[model samples]
Target: MADLVAELAAAARNHTALARRVLSDLEAGCRSAPECELRDLIATSRTVPPARWNQLLPGARGIYPDACWPEARLVVEVDSRAFHGFGDAPERTERRRARYASMGWTVLPVALRRIRTEPEQVLAEIEAAYRAVLSRRD
Candidate 1:
């Protein structure tokens, strides 16, 4: 899908600015709107470390996090109530987080509402988590 966009952008004669931006975001592994927003925030922030979107972490037991700084062993998951509020989804999320924790992965969960309303705070938390994890390594 991203390849198609890149090709289209390359072939276009004019007005490819938005397509280029979308292609860049897609290349950065952003699969959702929230992930793209986070990617933009991280990209623009000097304090926050860059993270790969929708990547599989090492020792994650097949779980692909929404965003991750693999070097710092930190993961950010955007949890939306629409997805996790039903049945045992919340429990499953908790269990998955526990698994990550047990494997030494720092899972930082951000609510979808918070992502929309408190982006700065979310970036702050991500910076804090990255610092905390790196500090522990040192």
Candidate 2:
């Protein structure tokens, strides 16, 4: 998908900047607007380490987290209301988090609304977790 966008950007005569920006976000593994916003926050944060979006974790039986610092074993899940609903959705999310936790990964779930309203606090928490994970390794 990113390669296709890059090709389009290369051939496009106009709006190449927009295409390039989209390509950059896609390459960074952003699947939604909220994820992109979180990525931007992490990118600009002083304390939080960079995250790899949607990467498969071998420790979690091939589960791909929303934003993960593989070396730190930390994951930040961007919870959007659009997808989460009544019934089994919440249960599934919890079970997923449990799987990551069982694998010794620190999982942080952040709502889409909070990402827009309290980005600073969110980043701070992520940074704190990142630091704690690294410290444990040391």
Q: TM-scores for all candidates?
A: 0.86, 0.86
Clashing pairs in 2: none
lDDT of 1 by residue, 5-105 (tens): 75885785588777777778888888877777778777777866678787777765578888888888888888877666789999989888888888889
Q: Candidate 2 — worst ten consecutive residues by lDDT sum?
A: 12-21
Go through the candidates in order and give the clash count of each. 0, 0
Tell me which residue pairs clash in candidate 1: none
**Reference-based lDDT, each prediction:** 0.81, 0.84
| Residue 84 lDDT, candidate 2, scale 0-100 | 58
Return the top candidate by lDDT: 2
The residue-by-residue lDDT of candidate 2 on 1-138, one tens digit each, is 856875885795685777666677888888888898899889988776678888787555668888998889888988887755567888888888888888889888899899899988998888888999999999
How many steric clashes does model 1 contain? 0
